[model samples]
Target chain A: MLKNFADKPLVIGVTALNAIDSPGPGVAVIRALRDGFGDNIRVIGLSYESLEPGVYLHDLVDKTYQIPYPSAGAHALVDRLQYIHGIEHLDVIIPNFDAELYNFIKVSAQLRIMGIHTFLPTHEQLDARDKMNLSKFGEKYKLHVPEAITIYKADELRKAADELDYPLVVKGKYYEAFVCQTLEQAHKAFYQLSAKWGTPIIVQKFMKGTEINIAALGDGEGDCISIIPMRKLYITDKGKAWAGITIEDADLLDLARQFTKATNWRGGFELEIMRDADGKLFIMEVNPRFPAWIYLTAGAGQNQPEALVKLAMGEKVEAFSEYQVGKMFIRYAWDHITDVSEFQQLSAFGEL
Target chain B: MKLKKNIATSENGFIFNPSTGDSFSSNGIAAEILGLMKLGRSADDIKQHILNTYDVEPSQLDRDWEDWSMQLKDANLTEL
Candidate 1:
C-alpha cells in the first residue's frame, strides 16, 4: 500500500540522472520507486547537465529540470529548488550524487519549509564516513579498517608509503584510487590524483581479499531497515561492478548493523568491504548514499528505495528480515535514441 | 562423496553453499554427481550409477569424477 496526498500522485524529485558505464543510482532508484508505487508516483528528474541519459528517458522520468551544480553553493541550490518546487510541487527530493549531497543536506530544512522531504545523512554522519576520516571512524567504532595515512605533499607520500609498505593503495581526497606497487607509481598516482581531486592524498595498506559490497538503509535512530550483501561477479576497469550476485553473509549483516548503530546512519548507504583469506572483513569505505546497483536490493526482496520513501514520509516501517541469497544483477549499456530538439529544449529552457 | 550438510541443490542444477554464500550451476553429469553426493552415496556407488546410466568408458568416468570432485572441493560444496 502506497500513500498519496489528497488522492493525487506523489511527486518525487530525483537527482544524478547519469546512467553511463560509471552510473549514478538515480535511474535504479527510480525503477524501484516505479515498481513500488506503479502509477501512483510521478517522477521529476533533476539533472546538472542536459545530456544525462535519464533526462531523455521520457518513459521513466515524467519531467526534467536542470539544477545548479554543487559548486554554486547551498543558497543557489535552494533558489533553484524553490523555483522547481513552485511548478512541480515535489513531495520528496532524493539527491543521489555524493558531490551534491552536502548542499542538499544544508538546504534540507529550507526544502522542508517548501513541503519537500528528503531522507539523508546528517552532517556529522557524512563527515564520519569521509574517505580521509574512515580510519578514525573505524577505530572509534571498534570495526576493522585498513591502516591509512593522509599526506598533503608528494614528499610526505614516501613516508606514508614506507609505513604502509609497497603494493599499497593511493587514493585522492574525493575519488580516484590506484594500487601502487612501487614508490615511483605511488608518486605518479599522488601527483595525478592531486592534480584532479586536490591534495591530502591517502595512502592505504593493501589488503588482499575478495571485495564484497553491502547496500543498507537506516531509520536515523540506529535501526537498520535493510541490508543486502553482494559479491561482484564482474568488474569494469574503473572498478565498477558490471555484474554482481546477492549473497548471504552473517558477518556482513552484522557489520552493517554495527555501522548503523554506531553512526545512526539516516539514509541509504553502502559499505565497501574486503574479506581476507583468513575470513576477516575490513571496512574499505562507506558511501553515504545508495549505490548505482541499488536495484539489486529490490530484486533480492528488500525494495530499499521504497522503504526509504516511507521513512522519509515519517511512516512507520519495519525492518526487512531476509532476502533471496542468489539473486544477481548484470548491468549493460544501451543507446537511447532521442531527437536533439529534446536536448535543446532542456538546455535552452532549463526544463523538459 | 559427501556434500556439505547445508548445501542446497535444485533439479535444474542450481547449487547454493550457505556457509560461503556462493552459488553455482552444473552440467547434467555434475548435477547427477552432486545429487548422489547429497544422498550420501559412496564414490563407487556414484561411479556405478553414472556408468549404468550414461555411455562412458570406466577410465574416462574415473578421470572426470576426479576433476569434478576437485571442482566441488574448490567451491566448498563438499565436505572433505
Candidate 2:
C-alpha cells in the first residue's frame, strides 16, 4: 500500500516536456495530472532540451532537470533518475516519449528498488506493438492493419512500392511518413526519411478513410480502466489534431478493450484508427503512451493520469464506465516569454 | 426513411450522429426536414410540411428533396 500524502504532496517526475509544433504529451499530461490530483501533487519536469517550454512553466512544474538522451543508455538514465529521486523523492515517474520509453522500461525495476514507481508496459508488450512488428501483431490478434513492407535500401523501395501498388505511404522506422502517388515520389521520400530516421524504411499500403483516435488506460490485468474515443475536427500540416471532440462509438471502445485484453497493457496508450468507406476499422498505429490530447480524457471525466498513478501505487481502481460525450478540445498556441538566465541556469547546471 | 434513432439534433441546426461520431451543421430548411424526420414523420409528410411553411414550388421541392435525401444518406445520418 502507498503512504498517505496528507503532509507531503506526491512528487511525480515527467519527461518529454517539448510542446512544439509536433507536440509531446508532457505538458498536456502535466495539466491532466494537476486536474486529477488538485493541489496534492508536485510535478518535476524531466526535460531533454533547454528550450522545452515546460521547463519554464513554473506554475505547472515546481522544478525542472535536464536528463540525458536515450542514446546514452539505461545506465546513464538510471543514474540521473537516482539523482532526481534523491532530492525530489519522486513517488512516480512517467516517461512520455516514444524514443525514451525503452530506456525507462529497461530501468523500471531498478527505479522501483530505489523507491520510484512507474506504470509502464512490459518489454514484450512494447515490442509487439512496435511499428515494425505491427503487421505481425495484427495478424496474430485478427485485427485489420494496413499491409507494410520494411526495406533496408533505397533500391528496395521500387519493389515494395510495386507490391503495394501506387499511392503508397513511405514511412521511417520511427517517425515521418509521406504518401507517395508515384515511384519518383516514393524514391524521394525514401531518401529523405532514411537519411533522417535511419535504415529499414517502411512502405505501407495507403488506406484512405476517416481517422479516429482513442486514448485508453489499462490496469495491467487485461482490464480497461478508461477509454475515450475522439474524432479530429481539424488537422495540422503535420497531421496532429488541432480540434477534436469526444465521441460516442461502441465499436471504437470495444476495439480499445480488445487491445488491452490481448496485450494486457498496463499504462496509457493511444490508438490511431482508420474507418474505411464500408465502415471497417483498421488499426493504423498503436502509441505506447498518452497522446498529446490526453487532457481531453480528464475533461471527459475519466482522469486517466490519476488512475494510472493509483495503479502504479498498487491501489485497486474500478473501470470508468462513462464519459461526457461531445466534450471538445481545441488546441491553441501562446508564446511563453522567459529570460535567457532561466535557460542558462538549466543549460549550465542541468537544473532550474 | 427517418433519421437514426440515436441521432441528436439541436434547435440551432447542429446534427450529431452518435453511432459514427460525425457532427454536421445544416441550414434552416435542412434543419426543419431533420426535425420532422426526428418526429417520425414520413417522407411525404416532411415534403408537405416544407410546402406549407416555405414558398417553394412543388416541382422544385421534389427536385431538391431527392438531393437532400441523398445528402443525408451520404452523411450517414438517415436510417433508410
Candidate 3:
C-alpha cells in the first residue's frame, strides 16, 4: 500500500533487540503503528531470545520474527537485517532499542540505499535523547531548565553535590532517574546507576511541581501538527503516568512549539515539563521516541504513530486541529490464575 | 467494604473535594460507583450489581472495588 512512497510494500523492520515480552514504550508504539496502518505495512520484530515474542503481535503486526542479538558488535544484527531484506522488500526500519538505535543511525544511509527509510535522528541529534545533553540544550535555547550538572566519576558527583542544594535527582544518562531524598541516597543512586550504565550521570536540583508532558510529532524539519499536553495526575513507582488528563494549556503548547523549532527536531518526541509552585515551566527531559502512553494520545485523538509513519514515508500528512481533551487510558497485563487475581490484574483504565 | 460520602463528582468526570482541595477523574465504572455511593449503596450491593452485569467473578470484583474505594477515601475524594 505504501509502494507509492517507495518501491515495495511498506515493510518496516522493527528491532526489539532487547527483552521483548514487557510492554515498553517502543513496543507500544509498534503496536499502535500496526493497528493504524494494518496489513499495508509489514512488521518484522527482531529480538534476542527465540521465545521472547512481543506481546500484542498476534493481533497487531503482519509477521513476527525473532533474531538473536549479537553480544559483541553489529554483525548479528546486520546479518538479521540481510535475512529480513531477503524475505520481504524493506521500506522502513524502526529500531526499538537504544543500543540498536546507536547502531542503526550509522547504517541509515545504507538502508536508504536499499530503498528503506528509517526515522532515526542523526548522531549529533541523538544527543537530545540524553538527559544531561537535553539540559544543556534547554539552557542553550533559553528554555527554563533546573539547576543541573553532569559528572562522570563518583568523586566528581560528590564535589558537584557539595556545590548544589540537597534533595537532588540522580539520573541515568539515557532513560531513567531517581530522586534522592538525602545526600546518602544520592550517593547510593550514583554508584548503583553508574555501575550499571557505566557513564556520567546527571544530578539536578529537585523541583517540586505538577509534572506535565508535551507529546508531539515534528516533520523532522520545523513544522509540527499535533500538540497533546497531558497532566500527570497519578504516578506509578517507576514515574510513569498512572492517570493523566488531556489539558488544553496554551502556554505549554507554545513552549513545545518553541522548543521543537529551536531543536529542529523531527519524529515522535515526548518532553517532560515541570510547572513549579511559582507557575514557572521548566523543561525536564526529552524522550526521542514515543512514550509508553503514546497509544493513549492516539486513543484520545492525535494518532502520532500513524502520522510519524506517514511522514517517514514522505506522504503529505494532515495537521491535527483538535484532540479529545479529557480522555484517559490504563495499562493492562496478564497475571497468574486465581479467583480474585483476574480482576486485580485485568486491564487498568485511567483518566486521560 | 463500603464507599464513603462527600465525593463531589461531576457528570464530566471532574471530582472535587472541598475538605482536601484535591481533585480526580473517574472513568465510566468509577462514575457508576460514585453514583451508587451517592444513593447510599453498600459495598456488597455494588459488588452484586457489578458481578451481575459484568463478566467478572464476585470475589475479584470485591477486592479491587474495596481497594479502589479505600484509595478514594485516602485521597480525600470520598465524603467520609
**Candidate achieving the largest DockQ:** 2
Which of 2 and 3 is the better model by DockQ? 2
By summed lDDT, the worst window of 10 consecutive residues in model 1 chain A runs over: A1-10
Worst lDDT run of 10 residues, candidate 3 chain A, spans A343-352
Tens-place lDDT digits, model 2, residues B1-80? 67888899988899998666688998887777788888898999888988998899999999998898899889988777
- Residue A5 deviation, candidate 1, in Å? 4.1
Please report the candidate that would top TM-score against the real structure.
Answer: 2
DockQ of each: 0.37, 0.61, 0.03
lDDT (Cα, tens digit) per residue for candidate 1, span A222-270:
9999999999879888788999888877899999999999999999999
Score chain B of each candidate by TM-score.
0.93, 0.93, 0.80
**Clashes, model 1:** 0
lDDT of 2 by residue, A88-144 (tens): 999999999888999999999999999989999999999999888999999999999
Off by over 4 Å in 1: A1-6, B10-27, B42-70
Q: B17-74, model 1: which lDDT tens digit per residue?
A: 7545578888877777778888898999989998999899999999988898788888
Off by over 4 Å in 2: none
lDDT scores in order: 0.90, 0.91, 0.69
Root-mean-square deviation of every model: 2.7, 1.4, 12.0
Q: Write the per-residue lDDT of candidate 3 for residues A1-352, one digit (tens) a residue.
A: 3457334447776655232233346566776776787666666655544333352344444555555443445666566677778877777776655555667777677777777777656777677646777667876888888888899877777777777777788987665688987778888888888887767899988899878888887776776767788887777777878677677666888887887787677777788989886678998887776666777777778888778777777788877888876666655554423343322222221000
How high a TM-score does candidate 1 get? 0.92
What are the clashing pairs of model 1?
none
